[model samples]
Target chain A: MPQGQPLTVPNDGLTTKARRNAPLLAVHTGPGKGKSTAAFGMALRAWNQGFDIAVFQFVKSAKWKVGEESAFRELGKLHDEHGVGGPVQWHKMGSGWSWTRKQGSEVDHAETARDGWAEISRRIAEERHDFYVLDEFTYPLKWGWISVHEVVEVLGNRGGNQHVVITGRDAPQELIEAADLVTEMTKVKHPMDAGRKGQRGIEW
Target chain B: MPQGQPLTVPNDGLTTKARRNAPLLAVHTGPGKGKSTAAFGMALRAWNQGFDIAVFQFVKSAKWKVGEESAFRELGKLHDEHGVGGPVQWHKMGSGWSWTRKQGSEVDHAETARDGWAEISRRIAEERHDFYVLDEFTYPLKWGWISVHEVVEVLGNRGGNQHVVITGRDAPQELIEAADLVTEMTKVKHPMDAGRKGQRGIEW
Candidate 1:
């Protein structure tokens, strides 16, 4: 037998129908990039294959942004066409960086963060869908909204048959280490940093 | 003003925005139903109006099941056509299901449930998507995989500006009570119970 290859046994205890468990895959990439985009593509691919799927968008509010929200709406349309039923759920943080700037330090971003994490914890324990995607997850840890240890504990103990993908910049080293698969996206070049504003339908 | 209507006094020391937070909606329907489908439609409507959106799919495996996976795979294509970027993301649960027939015990189911919830909790805490959906969340709880209290904690504490949705039959009483909106799908009729299996391009 080749090195590192499993040795076949004619009468081993294992049956021909026995199946092996699948490991988790995590996608972590840098800022101003397509980490979430790539993750979403993978999700659509999995969903079309008849697997049950669930999605949680952390830290974001419903306020209209230019690019991200519009594309999500399109995904929702696709979900509808496919007749996969579930509420496209959201847990929004009341505070935003811009809003906080205008309102001063009185804004309570911490409460928003706390509230968001609580819901997240519950969903993980419940294990409703076969696949989950965590978008922009790194920020909570980066912003000190939640602890890395807590995140690790939860992920380490997750159920079998569940696949997860996480996207963000500045992912914690612990998270990267815990993940079975990690992909980093480097921004080679972009039109935004050159001082040209984002264009509608292209950037937004 | 009507009895239930608020009595205003020159703004009452509060801004109009403060008086009403954005509407947060959640929909959890019955088994083998279309909760995600309805939520997705709402997301599309919100997106077309120029809202910023985000998406996360929970408990998904890499194995393709139907056409939905293909649609998620084409998320980048959708983004390219719509000129939206950054908001759409996806995550998959790398682990597959915990089989009851194989394990042959409730304890195995319970363990799987616990693991599943842990993953869901981790993702919910980390990401920041505007429209969040927990598909088939009630399954583990129903099957005795996890406790209901844990599920409640997450749902109750999520941030504002997120319209959250959850789907499944026999949702806990607390979830319904806490929700701003709730819809229970009573199956008046279903094709599967009538001896017809799910039809592709329609059932999925």
Candidate 2:
């Protein structure tokens, strides 16, 4: 409430309630950090609520061990051993299937990406996971490996209470338009600008 | 690697390495969601690495049981019981000090905010925690409750390996300039745009 501000209720929509309890399509895109971290935060919340979770990374190499990946994997173990929460699935760039420079051509990479999208689309249609985190999915879409139009169409009619979150830079316009939520991380300043590198335990 | 583009190394620090591990003053601000959530994610990483974590939340109500808070609390309990990682401390806006409409005047709220910041400043100076997540701290700075100059000066001179993350919307300019890292979370769209209310486990 700012000074002298008259608040008028929007007849159109009052966040009085979320739209029809429909599933959400969220995108986290930009140059700044924390996009994936935020999505993982959401996953953590969903997991606490007993929602099955699925995490699929599109760009970060499997060779690079991320902290959230490790944390979530541990949580998955806890779920299995102690019945603390729901099941968890995590698939990184090179884990399930991948396109490395040493293994394939750009065209081959394109097909693999398309195949990944198709699987994800099918999962959405079948309501596979309660919450899906599509980490760094923008690179493939931006590189033309996957069709943004198809993604928009599939997500629009996924038909479930499942939530989806996509993270990366250069998110396609069509996807943004279709998403129920989108966050663009803007970098105002960075330690790198002043000569700094990421440290362990902090970055991963 | 863009089309036929020659990759040149940036003369700037490539996060090739971080500074002499000086204490970091990081800010997460803007109009979108995830600021506090991302900071909590960092706390999770720090905790995994055996770093003592302190989370001081400035805004979200005392009644609100944020998922991250519950998760970290559980981790803390594990640390005590099984030495799983490190110790964790979480204090929300109303838990330690608060500005509930029922409590007092605007000036009183300002004083409480200043006191809260003072305690945090003292902890930073004493290196009480290896990592500090000052959730929604920017609101106090923006509302003129805490002195941005003082916050900036202290952080600039606070010599330790400890890392600090401040989060909220509309961070002050002086604080942003002083920060080692600053991210502005721009909102592209929101569920509220389509008449949605915060859902359980989701908004919390």
Candidate 3:
């Protein structure tokens, strides 16, 4: 905390009494790995706090299974069995969505991405979950499939204590400006640079 | 991956045939949030691979309980009950370390930090764990408590398939150059900029 300049408080001074608890719009975008993973970590924390958590992975192939997906799914089941926490729901582009159909073309992919965004807009309107993680969501926006302006507007006006996190590289300027918390994962070096392939469990 | 120049492969190409599967030295350092959180997520991935996981938290107060601590502890316990995964050990500066004796002075704090480094050096040499997460480790190095040269040397020579992750802001240049993977968390926005304080689950 003391290494660099201490973060500036918005007002001259912000005491606990003056602290307002508001929903956060967090964006994790960068070339370095783990942008989605960090968002998942936040989701895990939110779930521990009993927040209803929803995950929408925009790009990961249905065949790919991330460790977080299974962990959260198990936690979701625990909610039903033990009634210890809130509900957990996860939807991936491949399985839960058929917007692009089984055989996908560029147009179909774009169409599916838009449908996905529309559904997210609805969820935001309904305040369906306390925490929403849009994994690899930046692609659709960056690809021009979903309008960045529209996404920003919906997120900016979302109601209640809904915390939304979007992850992927090259986040739009509008979305970055709109977010309350944005972290860009800048890559310094990687094993991949050493002509190495990502390992199972480590990379996926 | 395609937005910027695609990352350069160390050589012509790295296929599974030539994949070394060597241990990784990864550093996560920056002003933005989630450096350590991303490391924790990587730890979670390693744990799923059944690698024995050890977390050494350098700066977080003993009283400040991060959600990952509880989650990993439970996962460790499950290793004994159901034999599901690897053992997990977490050591924070406050309790496990007494180099500063409880009451901390500038000089005393520096001594404690160095002691922490010494212990980590031993662990690296001993190959104590498959995965090592040095949370907020860059602080001691940045503060000049530990010799960066010694650290780089020890880590460079560590044996076995031991992976190490270091997280903190303002990491030394030498460390970045030494690491196999280095990520700098760049800040784009924050809740504090809007006069909002961190929330319980989100911040921790």
Candidate 4:
């Protein structure tokens, strides 16, 4: 009924649009917790929403010691059956801790880290999938095997449409500030803290 | 001094273990040339001998575009400094690509490549590099991001010697074949086939 007043647009549609284009979330916190587990849950939810997903386990090897690798292997089968636009790709850093145990600082761990990052970067750049998970990535950077600036650049410049979730411990403050959502997975308690050691299935 | 069958074994100066370790050589090659130029002549060779070396570059970003963004803008003055690791680090993957007037497949660009290969499996498992180069790593695996088997398990199992080199067009093969040394650069004449472009101090 106010003739001279400017018309107000509805806020609901704008909020929906903003949620659709939300920047990626970064989950990090103290060690010995369930950050990856929460991320995997989100991945499942995204997959259910018909989004293409790719998971890159940065520091893991392909030996399939844990059940997650087997589940991922099965996901590959499901992806093939569904004929998804982008397949679920898993990249592992091949070098285990044994060599590091022997050589100490002699090895160029940085290059190895760079190599792993390259694979993840390519997938993101190519838009191979809608959602990507870089698991256990922060540890290598913290250990000084990768340049933080380079990592920051890649994350900062990622295509706006793509969604990414990075899970690790002690995420740098810069990453926290850059993230659209940051979840800290603090460990209130764990069986490992009781000295029972990590068990199969649940711990993994 | 000449008796039936006996010459005393001499410990004097005939040690079989006196050979020096061979330098690691990695070549980056693809539909686009200059992989080697980016790796060795530009970056790896410039670092001091004592410093560790790791090289990896494939299809470069638009940052290399003359007016848009130069290597100087992307990498800063690190190239001129000697204590810095190497030139190839700049090649790692700059702020990624800016979409131009041309409508292209975002699915096939160089932006996310560094993430995929940054923490290469072999590097994580072995942690073996005074120097390492992953050159021209985009081609073969362009369609199918390389399997966890090739990158993590096989390549990650190499010796902990001082250097490691990985160069080729589309790095997908069994990759299980052990390499004390490996080089994969395709041979062909380029547009500098026709003299339209020449090597610049930074890109070449």
Candidate 5:
């Protein structure tokens, strides 16, 4: 494919610019690394463009300190203090949804995931952010904690210039079908095959 | 696969921690998006861990602006002031290399690429950076502007805990064979297929 050019132009009636500026729903899946990392990378771009950025990391421990979290949090501060970039909000599953506070009960993984989806659903309806990253969200859908049909329905009707990217392994077929851009990160080889333990900087 | 666990551990006789801490040579290739994006994301993680970073853009025009470049430049500043992260150096092909000054001559694409490889090779030999990103380096190798055999040899013999990641399309088979981790970003769907032009912020 030519750099920055589409392989084939469909016979859709929309003009090129209109189609290019349309909102996109992207899903990054398959049994490989870089799904969430790539989503975060896109978030960096969106932030640079001054697009509102919100990242919801599902199925990861709240205690886990991801490098992206710190980087984005700093970027958020930079936006607030220096106005260098867009605002950023990073939320994880174990922690209560950032939009909705916890109900003061022990965390139930399934219920928490459902609440997370509900919050995201409400945000999509309101067009809360220009760019949204549902990081590692596929696990909840695959485990039936969140309804795939409902998720797809909301995403299909997002009706704005709001882009959403979901990242995780084994994405549901329905979700893939609804997505505008779907990438499968196929692992040809990995360090773990040599029994490498996950390192601090590279793995996280 | 289990999170952070290898499917099968080879009997390389190295301890688990040693294997885990071992430097990795990763390749992100194929006809899809996020090859460079994911590499930058990894660079962010490496930066947070205080790993020195050096990014070399091989094939892209220096006139082109990538969001990651600005973001990393800012992070590099944060490191200089508050010392929050690692030092960062970003270089493009058109400009003189960071390590080597430019000769007073017009830009030659193939020669510039070879110069970039030579600098990276010297850095690798000296273990200059903890993490290195050879962004879009595969294009030169694919075009025979640089020797793929030499690259494979240098990378295979790269000593110390220096991690290197090369991102681009059409990676040579020899480089893939030499890499410890290879991820092919296969495109299932793309916005361009709908006759969309590359949008700023997202595509850049």
Candidate 6:
């Protein structure tokens, strides 16, 4: 599609400006790379536009220091100190959210994921952030760690101008049906095909 | 692929560490969104790891104030002031590079694209930036504005550890063959499919 131009216009009663400004529920999924990275890129754009941003990583290990985490933390710090951008919150689901602690209990991936979804659902109901990134969230829905039906219902009825993006592989048909936009990152080729491993600042 | 792990190990004489650290030529193409966005996301990671970044926009108009452009400018300024991250240089081809000015001539997109490729080629030869983003570059190759053969040659033979990412749809087969990683952004669904137009922040 050409920049800023839609191929067709629906007669959905909404004006062009209203339809254009409607918040998006986007999903990035497939068996390729860059799904989370692309969502983070959109987060950067949202932050630049003064939109409050929140990211919840559902599947990645909390100990994994993905490069984007540090970069976003730095961006958050920049916003706090210099007021150059909007606020940011990053949370790793099973490790307990950064905002709340599950004190002495041993980590349970499924329970933690459920709790994380609960928190996110609460936030969506309250319109807590302008932009929400459910990073790798598809895994939870796919594995039955969370209810896809409930998640879709929440997202479809999310209030205000809140925009949400979910990223992972094998996104559920229900979620895809509900999303306003969806992109599948198909792997045409990979270094792994040539027996090459991932590297710092690139894969992470 | 799992983090930092390859499915197979090549018997190509190089050590695993050496192969892991080898620079990449990644292509993000196909008929969907977020190709350039994902590349910029990689740029963000690269910058966090102290990689100098140079982004060349080949198809976007110079007048387009992409949110990432302003955000990177702020990041570049932050680097200048506090030494927080790596430096960044954002360039829009046809309007002339930020480092150099072309005076007294009307813009010819094809010639300007060729000039942009020439500049990128020279930079690659000199090992200028640690990370290079040739945004929307495939169009020039597809349209015969710049040569795909020459691009593949320059990228394949580039010296040092410069990682280059090319983004746009309809990537040439030769270029894809030479790339270390290639992701095709397939459009599963889009807001435009329902007649919704692109919005600011998300589209730009």
What lDDT score is found at residue B142 in candidate 6? 95
lDDT of 6 by residue, A143-184 (tens): 999999999999889888899999999999999999998999
Worst 10 residues of 3 chain B by lDDT: B1-10
Question: Per-residue lDDT of B1-204 in model 3, one digit per residue for the tens?
Answer: 322123554555655544646678899888988887788788777777778998888874664446777767766765666676578998777644643355444346676677788888888889889999998889889888889999999999999889899998899999999998888888877777665766756775
For model 5 the local lDDT of residue A169 reads: 91
Tens-place lDDT per residue, model 4, A27-53, is 433442345644553444444344676
- Which of candidates 2 and 5 is the stronger one according to TM-score? 5
Per-residue CA lDDT of model 3 for A44-78, tens digit only, reads 77776778999988874664436777667766866
Predicted complexes: DockQ each: 0.04, 0.40, 0.44, 0.01, 0.66, 0.73
DockQ of 5: 0.66
Candidate 2 residue-wise lDDT, B96-133, digit = tens: 35323334333355666676788888888898889999
> TM-score, chain A, per candidate?
0.71, 0.84, 0.86, 0.76, 0.93, 0.94
Better of 1 and 4 by TM-score: 1
lDDT of 1 by residue, B39-62 (tens): 443444344444444433333333
lDDT score at residue A2, model 3, on the 0-100 scale: 25
lDDT of 2 by residue, A51-156 (tens): 8899887753553336777777766766787777668898765533432333333345566666668778888989999899988899999998888898888888
True contacts kept of each: 0.07, 0.48, 0.54, 0.00, 0.76, 0.74
Instruction: Name the candidate, 3 or 6, with the larger lDDT value.
Output: 6
Better of 1 and 5 by TM-score: 5
TM-scores, one per candidate: 0.43, 0.85, 0.87, 0.42, 0.93, 0.96
**Over the full model, what C-alpha lDDT does candidate 5 score relative to the true structure?**
0.85
RMSD of each: 22.8, 5.1, 3.9, 23.1, 2.3, 1.7
Error of 4 at A111 (Å): 1.4
